[model samples]
Target: MPRLLSLALPALLAALLAGCSGLPSRSTKAEKSVYQGESFAAEETFSRLFDANVEDTCEAARRALLSQGYVISKAESGVVRGAKHFQPAGEVHVEIAFNIVCVGDGPKQQIATAYVSAQQDRYALKKSNQAASLGVSALGSISVPLSSSDDSLVKVASETIPAGEFYDRFFTLMQRMLRENTASR
Candidate 1:
C-alpha cells in the first residue's frame, strides 16, 4: 500500500505543474488582444480625419461662401459625435456626426446649416506573435475585412444630417421669409 501511494503522489504533482504552466500563456494572449483592440480603434478614427485636414476642409467651405460676396454675420461652433464597434473576426466600424451653423444678413438674415456623417470600416490586428518574440513593440498589422458592407454607411449619414441640418435650415429660411413679409407690408 505504501509503495502504490508513493507512485501516485509523484504523478499527481507532475500533472498539476503542467496545467499551471499553460495558464500564463493563455492569460497573456487574452490580455494582448484586449489592449490591442482598444488602441487600434482609436488610432484608426483620429488619424484619418487629422490626415485629411478636416479643419481645413471646413474652413475652405466657409471661405468659398464668403468669397461669393455673402457676408457671414454669425457662425456657431460645430459639433462632432461618433461611436465605434469591434467584431470577433477582427473588424471595426465607426460612425461620425458633424454639424455647423452659419448666418448672414442680406435682404434678410439668412441661416445656412450643414450636417455630415462619415464611416470607415477597417482595423489593424495586433502582431501578437511578433510582440511576444521581439519584446519591443505592441503595434499590429492593419487589415480590411473581406465581408464588410457599405449599407451602414448611408444609414448612418442619413440619420446624422437630415433631421439636424434640414430643420435648422428650414427655421433659418422661415426667419428670412418672415422678415421679407414684414418688409413688403
Candidate 2:
C-alpha cells in the first residue's frame, strides 16, 4: 500500500505542475478608439489596390484609409522596368514593379509600391528548380503576410486622427472593415 501511495503521489505532483504551467502568459492590451461616421466604399477601394487573393494587407490598408475618411479615387497596377542583367550562356534578368495609389480630400496621397525580381542562380539546374518551387509556394504566400502587417498602420492612423473629423470617419470605416473581414476568417 505504501509503495502504491508513493507512485500515485509523484503522478499527482507532476499533474499539478503541468496544470500550473499551462496558464496564459502576460500580454499587453492594445488601446481602442471610436469613430462616429465613415464610408465603406473608400475602404473597399483601398483594398482593391492589392491582389484580390491577398486579403490581409489589403484589409489592413483598407481599414486604415477608411477610418481616416479618405476617399480612394484610383487603385491600379503598373509595371516599371529596372536594369537588365545577363548570366552565363544567354539569360536576362529584369525587375518588375507594382504600384498603388489612393487619393483623398487633402494633399496627402496614400501610395504603396511593391518591387519583385527574379533570383539568379549559377547553375541552370538549380535556377530552374528554385524558380519552379518559388512559383508554386513562395509567390502565393508572400501577399498574405504583407496584408497582415497593415494592421499596424491602421492602429497608427486611428490614434493619430482626431474624432468627428474627415480623417476620423475614414479611420473608423477602416476599423469596421478589418473587424468584419477578419471575423469571417
Global lDDT of each candidate: 0.38, 0.37
Q: What value does the lDDT take at residue 157 in candidate 2?
A: 12
> Positional deviation of 14 in candidate 2, in angstroms?
99
Q: Best TM-score goes to which candidate?
A: 1
Over 1-185, each residue of candidate 1 has an lDDT whose tens digit, in order, gives: 99999999999999999998877665466455534644434323221111112333334334433433334443334333333343435333333222333223233333233333333344434222211222224556544333322323222212222233544443344344434444565
lDDT of 2 at 117: 25
Enumerate residue pairs that collide in model 1: none
Q: Which stretches of candidate 1 lie over 4 Å from their true place?
A: 23-27, 30-75, 80-185
